[model samples]
Target: MMKNTRYITATVLDGNRLEIETPDLPIGQTIEVILVIPETLQASLTLSDRYAFLKLPIAERQKVLSMQAEAMIEHYENNTEWKDLMTGDIVEYSEP
Candidate 1:
């Protein structure tokens, strides 16, 4: 049974599909991930602050681009910020 929201197991794997595994969801259900990088930003890859790809490290930039990265973390939650896991080398996680 599902214990609590705090209970979770994180693993690292690489593949084509999205790696999200929310607890209790049926395995075969369909999901979607959209890359909404603005065209203006795409056209101006040299710019920072607006274009995230230009600001990231080479490897991280590859992953972000490969994923066709979408919205900035700020778009989801006001208080939450997407720290550059590659550049910052800072990992933030909650105890389960």
Candidate 2:
């Protein structure tokens, strides 16, 4: 069976409950819920930080870039499937 998907942003309330208010949704219909947390809270660079980042020495900048690349690799390995550009298919990571 095909399903309709709707995206809604909700805040977690006390006791780990999410309060969602949407008039378009039916009162008694069952729906699947997928929670996507924002990444800005963890690793976002602000405008002022961007200026400071540009002023960093070459070695420091390379270190920062390497760290970010590792973080991206780790995040993708843990939470997502990789898309193979040559085959145009999604594949799970397997250790080489």
Candidate 3:
């Protein structure tokens, strides 16, 4: 199971409860919340972090480019046409 961490600021409420307002996560998912002192907490990266690899240095960029090219070549070599599973055959699909 992959774990995700989110940093949020919540207001302390009466009766030992806290209220947090976040817009990213959808409703109905189980989440674990932990309390930490504001001064000691560091915020996690946002969705933009996924593309941070594009910011890599020149040598790293070359490595990434080479890997992408290799992957494209391998895909073209091993790819098969889409088929109809129930009919057990390759079927050309046309848009009406």
Candidate 4:
């Protein structure tokens, strides 16, 4: 897991007792949300099978994840300026 480079947050309230949430991370070519924990948590409010990630079909979940990622990528790419990875050219990333 990556630690604190950057992240996006989504807060969705699922009724009163449940809330849907995930950490949105930006990777090489896309942003990703980790819906599953690689290890167990150390609290009473542990995430389990009640989440949408596990409840929805994997394929449909992936589509939604992808949409979120694309929007996130577009957000930063549109909001910031970037220097060419190789060339010294400074370019403001504007969504076309």
Candidate 5:
């Protein structure tokens, strides 16, 4: 039986891949993944953003690059904006 559900917001890494952070699950656990891409996020996926990103210096560009799973988890660990699904409370967090 399923234990609990957790909601996470993450950025897409490479094409068609999402990076999210949560507590570790059992080694052999079976889970489902559902993605909801917002329209604003879709707009950011356009050629202009790609071009702008490409124009950035390597160092700056790397900063904007998508976070890997490990990095995403680290970011989540330090994040204050993580919402509570049970109580519907919101904590403010801003990316550095």
Candidate 6:
């Protein structure tokens, strides 16, 4: 059997939820979902940092990312200071 594939970029919403829109696909149709965390957005690491991180085993890399996500969430939750410098629109991140 042949398979049709489509690629879409989506943002990870709060609570790790993703909202995918596939207008072409029929409603109630079964589709496979494979989440790819682009290296550029993986914890917002730098090029050199990502290179070093990619050296770790796959399992270890996952563990590290999970921990980083948890820490970031916790930091935001506990943080009370809102500096003027912190007020800004979120810009798309990319590696140089």
Residue pairs in candidate 5 whose N, alpha carbon or C atoms collide under 3 angstroms? none
Candidate with the larger lDDT of 4 and 6: 6
What C-alpha lDDT does candidate 4 achieve relative to the native structure? Answer: 0.52
lDDT tens readout by residue for model 4, 1-96: 533423344454666343433445334445334542212332334467447456888876776666567765776688654534446767799899
Compared with the true structure, the alpha-carbon lDDT of candidate 2 equals: 0.67
By the TM-score metric, which is better: model 3 or model 6? 6
Candidate 3's TM-score reads 0.32
Each prediction's total of clashing residue pairs, residues at least 3 apart in sequence or on different chains, is 0, 0, 0, 0, 0, 0
lDDT of each: 0.49, 0.67, 0.59, 0.52, 0.61, 0.72
lDDT of 4 at 78: 85
TM-score of each: 0.24, 0.40, 0.32, 0.32, 0.33, 0.40
lDDT of 1: 0.49
Name every residue pair that clashes in candidate 3: none
| By lDDT: ranked, best first | 6, 2, 5, 3, 4, 1
Best lDDT among the predictions, by candidate number: 6
TM-score of 6: 0.40
lDDT of 3 by residue, 1-96 (tens): 555656455677899788776778789867765344332332463557436656767765665566557655666668644323435667799999
Rate residue 96 of model 2 by lDDT: 100
Worst 10 residues of 1 by lDDT: 1-10
Candidate 6 lDDT over 11-93, as tens digits, reads 98999999998888898999866455654666776799768779978966776676557656766688757555689898999
